[model samples]
Target chain A: MPVAKILRLPLRLAVHACSGLVEPLRALARHRSLFLLLLRRDLADRTSGTVLGFSWLLVQPALQMLAFWFLLELVLQVRFPGRIGFLDYFLVGMLPWLLISEAVMRSTAVLNDLSSLYSRMAFPIVLLPLLPLVMAGAIFGMVYIVLVGLLAGPLAALYAPLIIAALLLWLLPLAYLLSVVGLFVRDFRQFLPFVLTMFMYLTPFLYMPQMLPEAMQPFMVLNPLADILAVVHHLILGLPVTAGNWIRPWLLWLVLLGPAWVIFYRAQPHMREAL
Target chain B: MSVIALRGVGKTYVHYEHVLDRLREVVTGRRCHREHVALHPLDLAVEAGEVVGVVGLNGAGKSTLLKLLANTLQPSMGRLEVRGRVSALLELGAGFHPEMSGRDNVYLSGAVMGLTREQVDALYDSIVDFAGIADFMGEPVKNYSSGMFVRLAFSVATCVTPDVLIVDEALSVGDGIFARKSFDRIMQFKQAGKTIFFCSHSLYQVEALCDRAVWIHEGRVREDGPASVVVAAYNGFLGTPGGAGAIVPADAGAGAAAVTHADPVAADGAVQPAPGAITARLLKVEVEVDGVVGRRLQLTTHRSNLAVRIRFVSDAASPVPTVAVALTGTDGRMITSAGSLNDQRQLLRDTNGVTEVTLSFPRLALLKGRYAVNIYLLCERGIHCYEEAAQIAEIEVSQEGLEQGVVSLPHEWAGSVES
Candidate 1:
């Protein structure tokens, strides 16, 4: 009976616990050149001879900030007077969301793009997904610098550094996970774009959770990106940092990731066969 | 010690000769197809450090023996044991990625051969030098020509230094200089005392490299012996006499030979031989694999051991003629064929006498396990046969799993690949 009980428990809890300790150590020990190779290949395919390779990373969130400013200020005439003006407040919110989306999109084709690599030889599937995930964060880091340096007012200096750093730390594991899931399911390529669309509207990306439809508020606050995005807004805009934001997403992340990691554990055998 | 052992190996494949048979199975309540047995039951063994060459007509189970050893296919019956690590090149360079560079492919190739990352890393520099790809290790393999790809793959494969190496006809390791290098490497491996098992149609190569050989006809082994014996048998069948013209060897001691043996009187009122030397010889011998007579030869395998059987009819008339027979491949390569007519010095006395000789093997030694034996009859001047059979006897080898070599040559060779 005890054995049965243990069997009934999710395997994700064990796999994630091990992965948490092992992953960071492994990443640090890897050759720098391999990581550089992965990053370079991805960048070359995406930006070959384009007008702006690095700028594309910066411009997306900046464009969102511009859209929000016009929509809230001119169309609806809404107001949230604070240490920073409306446009600056929006940029702070948009940056982290942009990073999260980029991470998800990069992972969508993690397996499909590597199908040729798979048939040709045996590959360490565990390490490969990390490439796209790390590159996502790297692109985010590049964009984050220009904003904080060129545009962040003196108040922006105080909390922006600490808040964005914390957000990125949480994202590494999430991005790695999504990459693997996208690889296993055939529907992910088509279904994910729609899921991303839904996840965005459900989170407080456009408006505060208080202003959201009441019944949806709990799910909205529990969104993994929501609490982190709120922390970023609070740090840059000087909103009350004690709102019911931080604890909920952190708890939800821990719960969801435990089960997700188990699914990844089960997927390795099938992945090798298909690859 | 036996390096390879087998017990009761067999294979049966049901084929639907007509398209309708396949379609009916999918839709009908019952399946309708005829079962075709490719290989029959066989039991055999190979000692460690022995080089064995397999010879048979096409479909005589040559490749099947190699495939079974490599664990590529599960035997229908019996068990096989291959001691130590066996590296198989059933298909040369099967897993090279076009987009990955040659250096990257070394790791990839090693993994397919069951080498780990760290192991390949330790041997990386050596593998690169062996492939002679120092100048092109960084470029994507797709850009490399077929010759370059083979060089890189062969380099990585040979560098691993496996305990047992199983090679198909992939011996044309590369072009020109690379081919020469590859040939030297194979010979080097042979000198190292590593066990080498190979199958090739080049009799000269097989004779040169293999000490032992096996001949397979219609999926069964006909003979296993020294390369010399097998090669001669294969050649005999190839140049066999054809058409309806018959060879009737002469009798040398029609009256005098018989008188000395105590049965001095002839049965057909012919004179008996006196005491002393009574020299008689076989004028010619002919054999066919499957077709009856005067039909076109349709051979399936090209192994050196298994071919058509020949029958001899001796006579003591004429000039006491000598007789011979042989088997050969469609590409001028010999399987299992041999006889003595012109090579022998003795001549027959009675030219009107007729006798019959039949050639046969234990089991068909082919993988697809099929071949047509060619029957040839030759005298001092011309050829002969009954009605001229295309393929002699349609034989099939039962593969229950005990079969060891593809052609099951009687003899075996010993050597190692360059480490």
Candidate 2:
């Protein structure tokens, strides 16, 4: 093969990733009012007719956390061997997990569900995949801060916004990839919830990492989400975490970014016709 | 420079047997589906302020061309550029959410049209006023009547006049009064020197409103030029047998001729409708010229009296069907056609759901040539075809004097000859 041809794939991948990351932000800036209207409409659609309206976002997660606290702390009276209490660990881990799972699950079907909005008009469909991330981010980001403040002091709570922002950025590539997959392969959306449930079990959200069987413990490094939670625990709870924990998720993100973005950009022309 | 231009742009829809085949093609970089060419590659350009009208039978790919220019559907091949702001009423209320309030839908539609919040705010009052549904703006659109919905949709579409306006059959919106109001609004847009592109079935409106007309036949530009000439050609084509090939009744299945049954059977040997099958159907059509009854007749231009008798069977459950007859020259140009719908006369039928209508013309003025007669049974609205029997009879006309045109014009010259 010629040298230029050999370099062409990587060159195009690099170009796509660079443009993909910036194009959405540019589209957002250009269509700020339209984006805001859609966001408002999305939020309203979820909470319309409810007495609490938008506050349900905060209340729903808080209620789930309370149920978990009741089961672990009050009912079972479980204790962890580490410096972190079982209740605090589960609470902190569960919030981020909720945010990630909600965003990912919704992202898969967002394009298909809202195809009517852009199908017959000249619309910026790229804005749709980002909606789930933004909505889920706002809901959990507020609750994460309050939970951290209640457990570890206000000083530790300051990292909540940064952590949520980082998680959203990490999810960006996955959101774009899964959206295209879900639209083209409709069966993927029907099976996504089970996959997410299995992922939740694979990650150490409900129990300590040390509680895993010896053989399975070694493979925890393979899951980037495990690495992500480890980093989150290290930040807010000051738990011991290795440098690899910090490097793994970011490395995975960088590796998948180019392909995911190129896939999404290439699929855009077909999106109008997909539905 | 042309405000709107297309260079060999066309659309081909690839139909996969299953949706996953599309993904397979993307992954494997191989063809996996059948290709339907909705439009062939064609070139076109329009000046900055031209009112261009598109006319074609249903399914003639007129909507495909408009959608491509409106930036809704991406063309499968070639380059298309439409400069300046382009607003399309391709479908009225297409952006509306039935669950949303009318007020919110207005803003939503405005946003979809790329209007900023402040721009929408400036135009909100005029839009609401024009639609005249201020009292119902708070309610959900699902609760609104069809008229109210179209009124609001049409109002929002036209309130913000863009450089190029694309409309599809939106001129005849709402009731008679609102239709006139919408027509006046379109006239205002034309007077403002904005480029307008619209497709409508009413050829009279197309001739009156458009400076240029494009007649698209089977996804190709069959004719493109001055409005009157192209419309006349299209109108002439509509009178031919093959012109109605693309038009199938809404409830019709499979083929175009399936709607018309050949002849119904009756126990007493009389023409009667088939039970449980209630579509309006043609029974018999007879043409007579100068006291002679036959399928073919010979007549003189100034002495022939032509008459046509048509019998049809219709269901009492459906509205009375209208009768139309056409006379066409050998070249398929419709010399003239008349319908009872245009006369606004109700056709009476017996208790057996059968009616016979005869149309007569005294002193036939056709100069010379063979002419074919066509009969049609249409729905009460006169738009939908219930049944059609094209070229059922033929007439040959002979003229004594040298007249050059298709018909003889009644004239008397008062000027003295310079001898």
Candidate 3:
């Protein structure tokens, strides 16, 4: 079969893409018990034999937040334009940032890591990529609860759903696309953590967007994470917000996700052989 | 109704010389990879409740066929309609988690096989019991033996009662006792009227368990028929000395239309018979029963007489030659051989340069299978062969009696049973 034949059937491709998107959701819903059990196992596997089992999830990110806080606030002497404290301002955006970062970075090797599932047993490949997301989500939810309790007022809780939606909208497509592409290019995994670190510095999560020179503000639009963090910062901290800031990230999201969806669906059939 | 129907089903894989070739093929609008056809287009329909065994040599596309049916690999071409759920035991411990306990693995594997948690829970105890490792269910499966692993894996796979069960050499593992138990479980499934497609190198198992058999040779179905007939033909093909290099005449056993071709001389020139010198050569060999001449000699009644006739021509100046014949199984193992010199029998020298000899068996006691005959003309001392024809003829023995092994030995029961 020619590649042109697959491209010609846009209707069929749309149907396949829709089904591909829904399959993981349906699998997770139908096998929620198994999903939860796997999630528990994943947590245990990651934390077992450590001195601090469950607390390690909080400790690692907390330490990283402290280190970044010291570097940005004390060393670099960066300041925000609002009345919100630096910890409060940073935690609000950092919570979702940590979630999306963990989901994408860990998911790059998710398929290769669970390759035994594909070769040894009859497993739904759609659910493989979702495992990391779900695992990260559980930890993220836990951390978010603690952060909201300690650092912010109850009003900040109202924006949790929107922040989560924004995070998933951005992370899911990238995770799916990268996981599929990662199977063919193993070096992508080796280069992933470096790239994610680079992405973090590029996004304005550590520093305020206003602190960036005016000339660099337009480039912030190019980083979807920057737009997402900006929305999260404004909604949770009551900072100033503009319609262009909130809406442009979503428009960029649409632009990024459309090709991811098509590429993921096209690559799915070939995944068995590639793996 | 057919539970599985495949029309012109085929699978082809594109082999790329380099990784960039694949990218180029996808990016550019040109084919840059070599196409390797794993399976040729063929039609097959398997009805519900039929146990069809696939017999083939390695790399003969048996696994590919099973994978296509199992829905693990997409067929490159053709239409395939598989009714009902398919559960394939393609390999043992395929979905097993090494760190998880066997019990947890069962639930996880069951869910992966499309069963809900509740369904797996309901069958959990039975699955553990069937695996016969209830004591170790709490231990991680990685600690289990290979047999135990296969047992747990097979138990979970079959516990769901899939509509179609495709097994590929999964049962060939483990101890003999466990193998028997697995076969019994499969037989129960067969009795329950589930369609089964089994592939194995053990032709005996295929013959014993399958209702029908499909012999795949070189990616094509060489023969498909009743299990006994197809297996017999395959056995005959394998028994030929040169493997597949020997061409089987189309009308091999179709009666008087005999086909003849010169046999290739032996590789050792010193051992090769003199070229163009027909001192003593066997012309035709046939099996006869009750004065009837044919290629196939059917043994309906036990202890029936069978006669093998050989026609030859020789010059008077040639040394008096001895005749020898051997019967070999389909696997090319020699069952028995007889020689005139070995039997201390004398041949009546004929001056006409033509002769016919017949070796008769008073009681033909072979079991059900195709057997091949090897004919040889030896010098007077029976030490050197003037000419020899290997697999000269094939005889098929069909018996209604259920017997195992290559031959049926005549015996009498004298002891009484205590029961």
Candidate 4:
């Protein structure tokens, strides 16, 4: 009986995790075309009035990366002390960082930004948080795959998609959590960009984790984003990585999945009234 | 089977001092907000193929109830069941995106309504033809005029008919031609045996379109019955004198002799407030026909004299109050009304501030129908009413021959038309 009871614990946790993941995916499937239509609308709204319309989706990100490369390589003369080229290393780390920051930043305001689409009507509101994820995934997925194909070979470029899929799954809980928090606590949205900027400086995107002072190196393990980038470099570049790097972020993700979903579910009734 | 059922369904809106208090209350499990009951718990059942109209004053929970049925709002407590594909035309542009082109929006709105791409393709041309904006379908909706915008939205919403349609006063959607078109579409839905829940202030339209009505007052069902009866009761309530803070005392008729110098007292004794300072109210209203003094009378068409004797009291300071008498059908339609002011007559009160006037229609020409008498005490101009006694008497007229409508207009066979 005790052995059976112990076996049921992992079974329960597995079911809990699957439910948290499956419920949203089911809702998305029911509203699959609507999700796509709204995703297109969201993508268009960002570049609607500009003279350079849909092309800006690609040009804007490319221009931003160019500026970062100019400042870090040409002006600051920062070099990576490794066999891997500095530009390849920076591109591999920076593109995924861009995808994460853009999706996370937009998740904070996604509900409020598209509230009119669902507020006064009967609509599936669960699809709203997924919009920013799919949008950022599409744009950065193409850019990352193309760049990786150029630097590391065609076979290695295929890993870019797997990398993006993992990041989206990891971001699922955070997106739902931030969407609810962002609407209820408006001040969180106001200073969120600053927080994202601070997060970027802490993550090893601009500088490798080794370059940080010896004392601060131990603390890098505390940032899940650091764990995420470490795994990505291991998978793509064959860099050395520990099992903790693999286990830490997924462990945190598992911890947050159920709570984030529960909070969002409880807050559904208040969403319309909050606006 | 009941298509819509609500058991103890209610909504109470909780207002927090700050938005954060909502969070605090949720986190702490303590009361931190005040509540306003938008709707009280009540049970209602709407059967299939019944057209029910909702009538109420502003902010009387009509919209809340409709939202509950439309699934836009969750009730605070109770079970609400609406069975069928319920389509709500609450706001025409609810799911419309301003940046999307009209063509794209049609598909988008179809998706929002749970239609597939194939379904939207089938309805696309019809929607475009109905909106009459085919040339501009490629333009972004933000560039469309308000009329064009609403017309397109209306076309999209009604293109596919649902089993039950809930309309919140969107009948008059655009310009005159388009309004007629939209009204025709709703009429078609009604003719197709679709159950409809309509809320509107247009009483005439409600009486014409709905078979039953529900009157919501202060978050409760005040009256619910046949459309004409509920509308008549609501009309009488609207015409009640004290609704607008008139100065007539509640017992004005009981103590008429002792009530003297009953003027609205001015702030300063030296200055007399000239306008509406005098208090006026009805003292007695008597309906007499064929030498019988009673509330309900039987009369012969064009042979009975309908006489109404009105006695009222007015202070000496202001103008004498006008007296008006109206005969109406039992459905609250005014057949005819006669006022002393319209005839340019001046009235005088006795020394005790009481005035009596009698209006007699000798040989009344009213045809065979049940009619009601309503008396009003009006201002000198006959515009503002000081007091009213609605449905004071009932007159049932019998005729020798068949004559339709409420009145018998004077006629004599037209003196042999060329045949």
Candidate 5:
């Protein structure tokens, strides 16, 4: 009897953890209208009082891309191994990076910012982390359309949607994990921007992977973000892709997502008291 | 079937001295914070088509129970089941964006209340008309007055009627006219056979609207029964001397007699006496019918005598101590007063010991309604009240004659209107 009870405990925990993944997806699908409304409200609120409304979304990434373009390509004279121009590489890499960083960074304070909504209303709490993810996706989609039109041809632009899906798939779980952690840890928000800056340097945003030293080149594969950016660069700029390039980033994302999804699902019920 | 059911539901909040302490507690799995049981485990059930009112003092866990039922707060222990879609109006204008116009906010607020865009579109004009802010719909909500903001929020919230509605004092918004309209709309919801969980300090509304009432005290359910019974018990508890030391007296001696003060009255038409703190403390205030102590004194038009007994303990010797009792009408007007100084009686000193005073009224002449008695221990000439209890005891009058105003006057109709 004791052995059976002990064995059942593990099975029960496994079932509960799996349900954590399924419950949020079910809630999101059921409350899709509310999710869309929140997405719309967040977008409208961001640009409500500004002189230039939706254009500010485009202006920000445009300005960042130009600054990096000048510093890395023009001033430092960095070059890729292939005929890929530095601007195309930077644009493709920077856009998804912005989407990922903004999603993670904004999610760090999303729970606190919407604490009143959680405490006062009857809406599903799982959808809150998705708000920033969807908002960042919308911003990325707009910027991606413009950059593809200007830099890449219309045929190459067709790959933008698939890239977005990949970026969202990677960022969503991270958003959920960080949002739950942020509710408990107050220092995460204060320390996030610095960590993101360090992470950007660690990734191949400003330069290509081959630009690094021979010893450091192989280590770039450990950063899933670098792998994702390399995949985007190859897809958008028609650069050659290595065999392991596609498998490594996806494997890393799956590895991160399983724990993240379980932690987020387990943390959802306790968030009400924590807040 | 019960629409809302809870079994041994409890919510305990861990309070940390600092935010870092919370993070440390979570990380190290060590107890670093104090736990506050916001609500103790209890059981309750509300069947469908029933409107239940939750009455309690400010920190009595009424709002906590409502939030738990609304699913905003997860109970730390116990099982709670709320069937069907539950829409809560916990705070008015909670999700309204100030930068958005009223038109846009109506849609956003509707969606927050679980209404779809098509639903909001269908009820758009009706919401605007119900809010009575048609012209201001184009302007930003920030520009709207607080009343207008509440009106729009309330309109949008009620437009989408759910199976269960939970409101926490949101109907006390807007002017009296709009409040009445909002209340009428709530009644319409009740007529449509929806379950409502309402929390308010207004016992009169609870008595009038709810089928049952629950009184929460210090995070526990103290009493729960039919609306009238629970409200009466709550009023008796409030009126009982030394029960609630924190109830502030209604500052009624501001010389504004015409103002309609909204004091909470129980179902039996007896106001909850304002419990005040004074230099001398009132020990007990009791009513008697023919010298038998009772909760209520039943009186007829021209028969039956009523007596009120007031007991107090003074701290120091008061020179020329006088006891006064004034009957205030439902509108907060002083209908009549009897004081030792006004009667030109001899002054009494050395009022340190506990003393009891009894005032009797032969043939109670007031009309059929609730009336409050304001008691005071004053110095000579009624200059200052050394001890005061405003609206301390209530005297309910039942008159057989048809008299509309405060008191009845003997008369006969001689003239008649001719067409």
Candidate 6:
């Protein structure tokens, strides 16, 4: 059977919720070695034994971004405002977008992915999705560290700490919300990639939000990725980010994430049975 | 004092289907519309530090009772209470994912089972050792051998130091080595004085492990007593009239087959077939060929992945539950009996429960043979719950050499005699 069927088995809301975990509460405190072992297991499981397994992680996005750039820059002759190489423009947005989207979207499937482990041990289901986010953010952190510490612009040097903090802040809820909902509906199995695609265009991955029509800019700014993208431009390019870009989008980020926090909170009670 | 107590405990679950049914029910305000009444307000009492083996045909409310004892299911109508920490391995690894490695399963499933991170950390080395998947821990279980998988799941289940441990028929699988290890671990739990409620069809395992036994047929318990007595009664029930001898109404299902009569007499008891019985039975179960009166048969209905089939005779109007077969030994200690009564059976439950014939033989794997068998039925009038023993009847075995082993098992033999 496909992986989808196995993830869908525990539909009993009564069992999927709180009471189901009475026997296995030790997953909360006693099992640190188990946690590390599980973390190592997750890494080994997804990345080993396949052709170009871990390497594919790097090759996949790098190829995707380069393809997009070559299509626009070489074939279509489209250019960033200042004749910036297509690579620079695409990398500036796609890199963070990849990190953010993968971090947020993939987080939802963590619990679903480890159904084998969670079902048997009575461990914490919350760790399923959260572990992936931590991994993604760590990967993102390394990337950001390289770009800012070694090769990024003078602006990257100025706002490095702030960018890291904001990214971390943005990531916490992103990882949490997707995970909780994943347990309930696993809607991400299909819609998550599409959301990432939609977010790609909305957040200036290919072009600045300002490049679009004025009417559309507000909608774009409503996205957290757009706010972060605009901030990235400001930090790395030394370009000015307008007050409307910052405030409105910040409010939108808060709004987008507010209910997600509540969802994460409400879901803990029912998580064990579902896991 | 009883650590576990129940009075009129019952459980009802709604059938679940696709998303559409769920949504429709949500909109129409029909909560769990299709109710599956599991435990029918049955009463129970178990003292602390006692090992109780629960015997039941599948869906006879065995899992329901375990889950309810763990508070995973609250009673719908009766008061129930337990004053201790419970560690249930019910459907061990109920949430394991093959994609994850054995190690992760240990942590994730361990946590799900109630081991705090620190507790898991402390027992990490021991858990890994117990799973015996030491090398495969870092590898995903998708690649694990079946034996290895069971080891990991079992270790994680028993890792937490629990006050009460509930084990299902987990060891029913696994290699002999792993089974022995698990058996030892369970024995250790016994020495430590943790209350254990073991559920399995293996009377040998139950006899070896439990001090007392409770047998359930249908959703109600039929017998509860010392291991020797209840197990003997259960075996007697399985042998002859217990199964395969059910009667069907002349107008039940379309194209109904004609009913057959039970045999006349056997070693332990006599078989008497009543006229106007609803159904027929054909069996070849191996009984105590010429063993002493007590411990006549140690029938362990081989737990197969195969489905089960069973037959029984019921009175027309209503059927009640009854029986207490006493197996008298030739020399000494009373070995066992196939009782129709056990303490676990809430005899007064199921006042409104179903009265259809139940067939429970695991996937028709029982070896065909000509063997002696016994029968007992608890018949009740229209509405009451307590039932009277129908008849302690006997029959001859006819199924012969269809398969090998005490109960037919799915195995292959590959050795050839030298020419």
Candidate closest to the true structure, highest TM-score: 2
Q: Which portions of model 6 show Cα errors greater than 4 Å?
A: A1-35, A51-55, A82-87, A148-151, A154-165, A183-188, A248-275, B1-12, B30-33, B40-45, B67-144, B152-161, B170-173, B203-208, B214-419
Supply DockQ values for each candidate: 0.08, 0.52, 0.32, 0.57, 0.43, 0.22
Off by over 4 Å in 2: A1-12, B23-30, B245-419
Better of 1 and 3 by DockQ: 3
Ranking by TM-score: 2, 4, 5, 3, 6, 1
Model 4's chain B yields a TM-score of 0.60
Fnat: each model in turn: 0.07, 0.51, 0.40, 0.71, 0.53, 0.38
lDDT by residue (B201-298, candidate 4, tens digit) is 65545765789999898899999999999977876664454222122233332212221123321222233222333366666677899789766789
Give TM per candidate. 0.53, 0.77, 0.72, 0.75, 0.74, 0.62
lDDT of 5 by residue, A104-209 (tens): 9989889888776666666578889888877888888888977886789888788887788778867766787899889878777889889999889988867877
Residue-level lDDT of model 4, residues A1-275, one tens digit each, is 99999988777767666767888999998988888899889877998999989889888788988998898889988888888667777788888999999999999999999999888888888899888898999989888898889878899899999999899989998999999999888999989989889888998867777889998988988999989998888777777788989999999999888778878888898899888
- Candidate 4 ranges beyond 4 A from true positions: A1-14, B27-29, B241-419
Model 6 has an lDDT value of 0.57
Arrange candidates by DockQ, highest first: which order?
Answer: 4, 2, 5, 3, 6, 1
Query: Which candidate, 2 or 6, has the higher lDDT?
Result: 2
Q: Is candidate 1 or candidate 2 better by lDDT?
A: 2
* Positional deviation of residue B43's Cα in model 1 after best superposition, in angstroms: 15
Model 3 chain A poorest 10 in a row by lDDT = A250-259
lDDT string for model 1 (B276-366, tens) is: 1222222232333443331232333333233333333333432322333333233233345444443443433333454444444423455
Better of 2 and 4 by lDDT: 2
Per-residue lDDT over A63-122 for candidate 6, one digit per residue giving the tens place of the 0 to 100 score: 775687678878898766664554565666666777777777667787667665544333
Taking the tens digit of each residue's C-alpha lDDT, what string does model 6 give over B36-131? 777777778888889999986667888878877765554567888887777876766565667776766777666555556676778889989877
Per-residue accuracy of model 3 over A1-275 as CA lDDT, tens digit each: 67878777665655655665566678678778767657765775687668998799888887887897788778987666667677677777787888987898778888778777776555677777778887777677666766775666666765575567556655666777888778887778888889879888887766778888888888877787777778777777767777877888766555555566667667766777777
Interface RMSD of 1: 6.5
Model 6 DockQ vs. reference: 0.22
| Clashing residue pairs in candidate 5 (N, C-alpha, C atoms within 3 angstroms) | none
Best by DockQ: 4
Predicted candidate 2 versus true structure: per-residue lDDT over B125-241, tens digit per residue: 999999989999999898999989999999988888889999897554665346546766877888899999999875655876789999998888999999999999997787567
RMSD of 1: 18.4
